[model samples]
Structure formats: C-alpha cells, structure tokens
Target: MSRNELVRICRSNSIESYLQDSKDVQYCSRDKPLIQFFKLNTNAAIDGDTDGLGGIIRDSSGKEFAAFSVKLPAEAIHVLEMKAILLGARLAAEKGLTYTLLESDSLTAVNVISEVWTCPWKAIPVLADIRDALFCLNNWKLSHVWREANTAADFLSKPTCCIKRVDIPVVDLPIDLLDIIVADSNGTIYPRL
Candidate 1:
C-alpha cells in the first residue's frame, strides 16, 4: 500500500477507536456496597416552580436504612442534584454511619463532586456543603450511576408532575417504589435506553 493510503487508514482506525471508547453506557445495575458500608443514592428534579430532592440509604444487604424527600423553590436541576447528595450524606452521618457509598444519577453533579469536571458557579455553595458533609464520614466513595438503576431515587425526586407517595420506610413505601427496591435487592439489571 502507498504511504499516504496507509496513514489515512491508520487515522480512520484511531477515530473509530476513540468513538468506541467514548460511547455512552449501555446498562446499569445497583450494586450492593461493601459489607461494612451503606450505599446512598440520591436524585433531584425541578418542576415548573418547585424542586424536589430525594435520597435513599441502603445497607450492604440492600435493606433500606433511611430515605427522604423535600420540596423547595425551583433551582437549576444541577444545583438540586448536589443538594440531594448533601442531604444524603447528612442523613448517613445522622444515622452514625462511618463508611458510605454515595451515588447520583446526575453525572454532571457526580463529576463535579469527584473533581473530574468543573463546577458551575451556582452549584458551588451546595458543593461546598457537600464536601463538609462527606468530610464527616470516616470512609466514603462517590460515583455516578445511570438513571435506570436509580429508579427509586428518581421516583422520589421527580417534580410536582408526579405525586410521590409517603415517606420511604420499608412498610410505607409506595408499591411502585417497593417494587424497584426489591428489584435492586435481587440484582436486576436495567438497560440504559
């Protein structure tokens, strides 16, 4: 083959490889945390005029420990995402949990908290508070998960568009939420799209 043709083929292959590596995730599952740690997953959303923040904490066995949902004036969804995480961390601390695994469906918020991406100015205050809350934990790790695996938290934080049932205790959780919890505990895998 001619030198120029070989160079062109190599560049095409390089571009294809880059695209493959950057491909969006195709599946997600809610993995249980380490034996001694609790996993907290949180999600947030903005309705026309209201923002809903929610989070759920589950033990290594995937049993629910605590969950919360709060409503407030509408803020950017990105900011609300951080607020949800902050609330989750605080809840774990309140429950005297030392080791924790925090998860969020907002990849942007998770990237910011992990310092993998730049922080938007509006979210800085909430991010600062999140850092403080995380600092209280003796051991912790934070990462992003796909929304499908975050079904329970997503249901909890959806805007006023949907009526979220009562608080998320094992007995009081809405049937739908309970079903999601059970699926997660059973290690059901969810498709990304």
Candidate 2:
C-alpha cells in the first residue's frame, strides 16, 4: 500500500481495526527503510507525590517504540511534565519519525499540551517547542492516560535520591516509597515491571 493510502486508513480507522494480526506484519528496525512512529512516557516526582505521563506512536503495528521518564520536585512537576513532552518531541524528530503520539497522565499537562488550558507561563517556551516539533510530523496525537496503565515510564522516575546506594550504579530509594509505587503500578506481583 502507498504511504498516503496507509495514512488515510489510519486516520479513518482505529489502530486495532487496522492491524488485527500484528504477527503477520513486518516489524522494522532502526536501520530498516520504514516509516517510524514514536511513543514517549514521562513522570515527575515532586515532594512525596508523582505526576505520570504516557505517549504512544501507532505505526502500522501500533506499538510503542520509544519512551522515557523524568523526575523532579513535586512543586515543579508540572514544569517538568512540559519539559518531558518537549524532550520526547525532540527524540522523535531526531529519529526522523513522521508519526508521533504524545501522552501524559496529568490532565493539566495534557490540557496545556492540547491547548485546552489557555494560560501560558514558564511552560510557554517548551510547549511552543513541542507545538513546532509536532507540526513537522505528518501525523500526531496527544492524549492523557491514568497512572496505573503507565508503569515502565513510572519505574524510570522512581525517587533515586531517597534510596540507599548499592554496588549498582543506581541507588534504590526508601523501601516504603518503593512499596507504595509498586503497589500503585497495576497491582501486579512482578518484583519489578
């Protein structure tokens, strides 16, 4: 199928409706000649609370290909969430991806990103950057997700400073905080997701 035809189909149909049999479709690598899609997730840790974000890029298969996270002070989490979106956009552009989805768990953040929240502040600059980067892509979508469904990115934002340092390069944070986050993450029993 031609690129324009595929894009038209994507715009008209749900991703699952387009690609029901993912096993039959060819999966492209970073080096292969293929259309690239990007998904990015981010979370910011402020004080004792956290704000999570999740972004997805539905290419032919509609799976997440690239994602990331960011942690910051609770009071500054909103600013950091905007920054994460900017960073995710930059990453997508760097990969030469033409389709992108930017998602966040914070409704406020998503609103600002989607231009539903009109007040502009410190985030105006980066949000503008995200806006500009988004224009470069042929297709894009921004969405909000509940924190429970976005675990891998949440894991990346765990409070590291509070954790005790082990031989590993990264320190594990306080057990109590870890327990709470782990429990919040889908209630799954995986030691680590």
Candidate 3:
C-alpha cells in the first residue's frame, strides 16, 4: 500500500483490503516471533470441492520447528481456520513448546479466538477445542496478519490427495514450501507484479 492509502486506513480505523490494485497485492515476509517464543502461522483454504488446512511453527529465529498440511471436509472458512489453529496448538504442546504466538490471515478466526467478537455458532465446537489446546501452553497470543505475510501456509493449504496428510519438520518439508521458508528467513520480499 502507498503512504497516503495507509494513512487513510489508519485515520478511518478500518481496512477493507490492503491492495495497491484489485488485481495485485504487495508481497512481504512473515515477522519472527519474540525471543523464546514460537510463531505458528496457520491458514485455511478451499481447493476444488475440498477444504484444506495448513500451519507452520517456527522458533524465535525463524527456523521451522514443524509444519502441517491436512485435508478436511468442506466447511465454513471460519470453522476450518479454527481447526487449523487448534491443530497447530496441539502440535506445539506435543513438542513441549511453552510460549507461542499464533498468527492467521483470517481476521475472523483471530477475533473469535481472542474473544474480540462473539463466537459464531458454526465455529463454537472447533473454537472450544482450540481453547483447550491453547490452555496447555504456558503463554500465547493470537494475531492477525495480511495474507501476503503468510505465503508459505497459504500455499500449503491446497488440498492434497485423500487421506494424504503431511505433518513434518523443516528438513522434510516439500521443496515448494522449503523455498518459501528460505526466502522468509533471508528477508526476501516478493513483489506481486
């Protein structure tokens, strides 16, 4: 976004889209988490007739600790997003990670998880599970970010073959996702031209 447009959005206290143009989005890298905290970026997307969820957990230095790509039955986007977060939180807890900063491109999911908005009926069950998973953590925070900053997770959110769920560490990540991870750690920003 341009300086003037950003200023306008700040003044208005509302954001519709952070677009330089309808056909384009300014790309960027994901921010690293605070020292001693892990960052888990999650995304939910629809591919063809199926729903998919993706998440990546990174250490404070931006090294990937774990990542997941799973397929789910078609559902509302908010529900799918909450499921992705829930799955991530469980993975982090299983790895004994104490501090976490969970991020998602879905503002609706963040707002719901943070209780900034009432939980919608469709998302209640999964959101409750998410709370349970997060409760096991020593400390955690929920945040919303632009989709551009969540490129890896977004790319990984495409549905794979049936029952072909992937949950693995950085070294085992697919080549495409590994490329994004490398770019993110190197502070390389892609311009969506």
Ranking by lDDT: 1, 3, 2
lDDT of 2 by residue, 14-96 (tens): 44443443435432111111255455555555546654332222233333344444444455667776776676677677667
Per-model TM values vs. the true structure: 0.81, 0.53, 0.80
Residue pairs of candidate 3 with colliding backbone atoms: none
lDDT (Cα, tens digit) per residue for candidate 3, span 1-193: 5745543543432333434344454545578878889999899998768899988888877788788888877888888988989988998899888899999999999999999999999888898899899999999888998887788778778786232334453455677777778767766544443
What is the lDDT of every predicted structure here?
Answer: 0.81, 0.52, 0.79
* Candidate 3 Cα errors over 4 Å, as ranges: 1-27, 161-169, 190-193
Where does the lowest 10-residue lDDT sum fall in candidate 1? 160-169
- Please identify which of the two predictions, 1 or 2, would achieve the higher TM-score against the true structure: 1
* Candidate 2 or 1, higher lDDT: 1
Q: Lowest summed-lDDT stretch of 10 residues in model 2?
A: 25-34
Give the least accurate 10-residue stretch of model 3, judged by summed lDDT. Answer: 10-19
